[model samples]
Target: MSPSPDTSTDTSADDVMEALVRSAFQVMGVMTRISAEHDLSLTQLRVLGILRDRRPRVTELATFLGLDKSTMSGLIDRAERRGLLKRGKNPHDKRVVDVYLTPAGHELEQRLTDEFRRDLAPVVDRLPHHQRVEFTRLFEPLLSPPLVIKPRVTPQR
Candidate 1:
């Protein structure tokens, strides 16, 4: 695990901002190395991880990945060529195409996820308790959209 930054002394707002960007880069550097080892970009790794559960329309995938549709198409094309994923007509809708990870792709994604979890556990564990909690409180919402509840349906006599 990386050593935690010393936060004991008085610090200015500018210092805090710089520290935040530095820490973020350190984390990103680690991920970049991991991605390189697997011959994938971080974005490709994320795509495989997302496809582990269920297949989705290409546009849906694009939206979820925060990528434009045309950009997503090229990414999918690359993955498809690498035999990591397949594109075909959606099972529920013949008109729409969905993407799915191949077995090899799923296996690779699972392995990477497991390894990251194990490797990051110590780093996360070293975080100050309040910082750890605050990090989750602050970032988890940014990662996911706010949950929306469905309206209840009524049965009429």
Candidate 2:
């Protein structure tokens, strides 16, 4: 059965849902263009963006990125070959290599983020001042907790 429509406006719920999807795609388009400007794929940009703040091992990164180990390894390998990042062993173990962004990685990440922000600024600025403030307030909570850039550490078994 179809769900009841929103009472707040004449627009149907489907319209609002469709608008959300379209808005997401619009953001994605901007993201894709920004990623291309830095010569990286969307997934690669995603990985670097996640690594911008802190380092994580391959296993942990895979879980956070929702990628398998082999796929994550390939991304890391390509990035490493491009001099964007490097792998080094965990301080307490000779075999556990952690991934970290290099100076170039940091530079690219920063540029990609800055450009994306610039691209988005106009969109947000087009809204009325109250809507802009409310949007920022609403968006803040979407980035907390489980969305952490660094995964929580667990004791080795």
Predicted candidate 2 versus true structure: per-residue lDDT over 1-157, tens digit per residue: 9999766675675676677789889999999998887788988988888899887889988888777789899999999999999999888787888999999999988888889889998887789999988977976775465553445579999
| Per-prediction TM-score | 0.67, 0.73
Q: How many residue pairs collide in each prediction?
A: 0, 0
Candidate 2: where is the Cα deviation over 4 Å?
A: 1-19, 91-95, 128-130, 145-157
Tens digits of lDDT, candidate 1, 12-99:
7568668778877877777787789999998898789789998999988887877778988999999999899999998788999999
Off by over 4 Å in 1: 1-23, 127-139, 146-157
Please list all clashing residue pairs in model 2, or write none if there are none.
Answer: none
Best by TM-score: 2
